[model samples]
Target: MPPASLPSPSRPWPIPKLHLRIDDLHHEGVDIFLNVVNPKEALHEAIMASFQWLYTPETVPRTVLQILLVLRPMDGVAYTTGTQSHKEIHFSLDHIKRSVKRARDEIMGVLVHEVVHCYQYNALDTCPGGLVEGIADFVRLHQGYTPPHWKPTGGGKWDTGYERTAYFLDWIESRYGDGTIKELNEWMKDNQYHRRIFKELTGRPVRKLWKMYCSSLGDPITDGFVLVSKLIVKSYKPLYPPTWKGPDPGFL
Candidate 1:
């Protein structure tokens, strides 16, 4: 007889009801996704990553009750949307197909990014969009899901977003000590976002922090331009080409 299924391990944070919706069963990406991961396990791990990286047991948000994963043909890699109690992660099968060489890692990375949105605070809808995205990618980076293409360099504004802003936040956490990002996120939960928060957290203004970060990377800005050896336009490459507009409106 086959072995019995093992019991699920206990989780400190709430595990929302997980669901999956495949828009096209016949899509080639569907086969690839299935071959690579167990949906339940993958989603669970993504949630745990957000909790571990972004929140402590006492501070983890308990608002999310359900998370639905929708796989379909889409323009970009993925975007998330839903009410406070529920979230839907719409992942692109087309993107998955293109990432066949690294489907599992890419899928997990995207999932972790989207899942962070479900739990992250938004400064009462007043936080800069770039900072919001940076936090998501920050958690993804901590979870060890960084794509091979991602590199840590500093040049542009501190809130440039994605891996750029993520690396900046990572630097803050390293320099200021752990839980710095957690405190930053917590402050956003009940107050409006102000540049002063950085000062409050690390005894320095955000601009000063950005300058130090750039200097550490040996890519300080000069005359309002990032003085680097070469500028690498960061993108998901073939999946999110240069022509791609930007994040979906519903992505927040």
Candidate 2:
């Protein structure tokens, strides 16, 4: 069964023209995919998650005219590429086969992530790739599609990407209040990315915030950084969205 339905915006956000292409029509992965989900519904739902979380009708990007989904045999889970007006998502049949039992959730999760790339700004490509990937996973996490293996623990930097940074962003949004993440994205819309944006969003240095986040998790970082005891997190809610234990994301 699909885990849970992703929430849609109260009012509809405009959906771009969506198209689908299956390069390996004969692949068993394609059968699993086609049997489990409708492409149109899947894409629409993916766009819904992205638009609901990342934009409003008034601020949504209109430059995108089409989103084409291409399912083919490839090395990775998925990736998105396109011109200003057109976007293409290449998904791996091999990955789909590997995720057969959770094909619906896995496919939809990847779709939502790639769709975010179609719409989110990258500070003229100056944003860290980890942050970008985290934002995409943030949306997926919110969609109730978090894979079984995902969790919020430590060892790497905050922007280690994917679930690690996604959980961190969720904590930031919760502690600071709504719109902080949205504003961060807007700040990057026209200007080049700078660490100062984190300051502007949370009134603290990014490095400091990362330390506190590590502390909140009771992460054992004995390097030069201050070790915030795990007790501090006891009085507070989890850093991620409440829906999932690790919790949820940001943007307008």
Candidate 3:
């Protein structure tokens, strides 16, 4: 279940119509996907994850009316596309086959990531591609579906996307408070992307936040002087690791 602050199943948020298209029924990945997950249930959980992490009942967008999941032989893991009212997620069956060892979790993670794209704001189509992808992965990270290879290490730019920026956003959420990222998302709904929004939310610039995040991770990106002496030889434990309260009843 989501925290008491978030909407519960009884007070369900709106869910778009979900449609699945399997382009190759005989593909081994198709069988793997079906055996590993119930499509309807998994899709429901993915949608709920977006709502739980990125929106409130009153604030959630209603523009997306349908989401079509297309499982086909593709080169990449997955990607999303569609009109304002409908979205299509193209998931790679080849990737599914490769992820057989953790099929259920991987499929759910990708679904959640792509579902986020269906509903997330994009700063009037001006948001940085990195931040856009970062927010999607941010929700995935919070949902506890993170891949084994993901880590919180920080050295590159903050908006490097994927788990890197997701971890940075997670750090911000921990440092500021819950709803910080939700507010960030809401800010992007009408405005163009700007570094100032980070300041508005946390009273610090995004670059500064990035530096602190890197320092916390023992990444030597601090400006000349070491930010944390303890991190010189050892990793500094994060003050607040992002929390995952597990799934609600019937969530999976």
Worst 10-residue stretch by lDDT in candidate 2?
243-252
Give lDDT tens digits, candidate 2, residues 1-252. Answer: 869986765655778899999999998889989999999999999988877777777777778889999999988788899998999999999999999989898888889889999988888888877787878887887788888877876545676578887877877877888767767777778988788889888998877677677777667554356554543543234433112222222211
lDDT of 1 by residue, 62-167 (tens): 9999999999998888989999999999999999999999999999999999999999998899888788888999888888888887877766567757887788
Q: Global lDDT of each model?
A: 0.83, 0.78, 0.83
> What lDDT tens digits, residue by residue, belong to model 3 across residues 1-252?
756773355545889898999999999999999999999999999999999899988888878899999999988789899999999999999999999999999999999999999999999987877788889999999998988888787764676578877888888898789999999999999998888999999998886777677767766564445443323332334322122222221100
